[model samples]
Target: MKSLNDIKNIAIILTLAYAGITVTFLTYMATSVRTYNEIITYKEHEINLAFGYLFLIGMFTLVVLLLFLFYRAITISNRLLQQADRASGNYTIVESVELDKERRANEEKMREAKLLFDKEVESKLTAMLIFSPENLAEDTAFLEAIMLKMAKEFSAVQGLAYKYNKTNKAFELAATYAYFSENVKQSFTLDEGIPGQVAVKKESLKINNVPQGYLTVLSGLGKGTPSALYVIPIVVDSETVALLELAFFNNIDELLQQVVEQLEPKLGNIYAKFLK
Candidate 1:
C-alpha cells in the first residue's frame, strides 16, 4: 500500500511537470509568433516558411506529449485497480481464517462445558441415590418410588418397572407412574417387544419418533402421545433382573442417558441385595 501511494505521488509530480512545460512552451511560442509576424511583414519569404515548419513541429511534439501523459494516467489507474483487488482478496482470506478459528474455539468450549455438566449431573444423582435410605423389602413400593423419582428428574411423562420372575422366565409389571390403561400388558418373555428386547440383551434402548398410539400421557386436562421411549435393563451377576421403561414428550438426549449409565452400579447393588 505504501508503495502504491509512492507511485501515485510520482505520477502527480510528472503530471505537474508536464503541465508546467506545456504552459511555458505555449507562452514562448505565442510570443515568438507575434514577434515573427511583425518581422515577417518586412523579412524574406524563406524565413516565414521556416518559421511555419517549426510551429508545425512544435504542435506535433505537444500532441505526442499529451498522448504519452494520457497513456501514463491509464496505466497508473489500472495498476491501482489491480492492487485494490489483491488487497481485497487478502482481507477476505484473513477474515475467513479468523472466523474459522473463532468457531473452533466456541465448539471446544461447548464440549468442555457439556462434559462438566454431565459430570455434575452424575455426581448429584449418585449423592441422591447413594446417601438416601429406603425400605427395600416392599418391592412394589420401592419400584414405584424409583419410577417417580426418575420421572421427576428426567421430566418423563410415564415410567414403568418390570421385575423378572426367575421361575416363569418372564418380565412382570411391577410398578407404574402417571400411566393409565384399561389393560396393560403384564408380562413379556425374552425378545418379545422393546422392553423384552432390552431385558434379553441386557442393554438400554432409546427410541425416537415413537409410533402413533404406542403410548400416551394422560393428565387431568387432556392426553398427548409421547414422542420417545427409553428402555433400560437392570442386570446383576450378568443376569437381567429387571427392566425400566420411560416415556417422554421429547427425545432423550445424551445427558439423560449418561445419568442412567452412572446410576447402573448403584442400581445393580440395590437389585442384588433387595430383589431375588
Candidate 2:
C-alpha cells in the first residue's frame, strides 16, 4: 500500500546509508593500520583480524541493501505496467460505448426514412384507386366515400363535399362525413364563405388559426373547434364542378400537402365524369 513517493524516499535513504558505511569502513581501516604500526607492532596482526571482520560485515550489509533496492525497482516497474494496462482497458470500453451510440442513432434515422417512404407509396396508391376510370360516377354515396377517405388519410376530423348546381347557380352539399352539427348550411353562393371564395376563384386555399366558433368537430366524448381548414376546388374543363372542404385539428404536414397536390389532377378527371 505504500505510495511511489514513499518507496523513492526509502531507496534514497538506503543509498545514502550505504555510502556513509563505505566511507566509515575505509577511514577505520586506514587509521587502525597507522596507529597500530606506530604504537604496537606486535598487536598489528590482531588489529588486522578485527578490522577484517568489520569489513566483512560492511560488505554483507552493502549486498543486502543492493538486493533490496533491486527488488523495490522491480516492484515499482510492475505497478506502472499494471496501471498502464488498466488505463488501456478503460479507454477501449469508452470507445466501444461511443460506437454503440452512433450505431443506434443511424438505425433510428433509417427507420424514420423508411416510414416516410412507405407512407408516400400508400398515399399514391389510394389516389389511383379513388380516381380509377371505372369508378367515375355522379352518385352522392361515391362523393361521400371520396370525402371520408381523404379526411381519414389527411388526418382531417370532418369534411363536406359540394357539387355545383348549374340551374341554381350555387354549390349544394352533396355529402357530409363525421359531422354532427344540426345547423350546418345545405348550400352556399359563390361569394358566401371560404368554400364559396375558392369556388369563385377556382383555386385551393389553406386556413390556419381559424376564428373562434368558426367550425367544430364532434365526437362521442365532446365537440372541439378545428385549428385549420382546407378548401379545395375541383375543376374540370376550366369549370369548377365541386368544392371539397376539410377541417383538421392540427396543421397539415408536408406529406399531406404533397398527396393533396398529386390528387388534384386525378380528382379533376373524376369530377369531369360526374358533370356528365
TM-score of each: 0.61, 0.55
Q: All candidates' lDDT scores?
A: 0.77, 0.76
- Global lDDT of model 1: 0.77
Off by over 4 Å in 2: 1-128, 131-137
Candidate 2 C-alpha RMSD relative to the actual structure:
12.8
Question: Candidate 2 has which clashing residue pairs, if any?
Answer: none
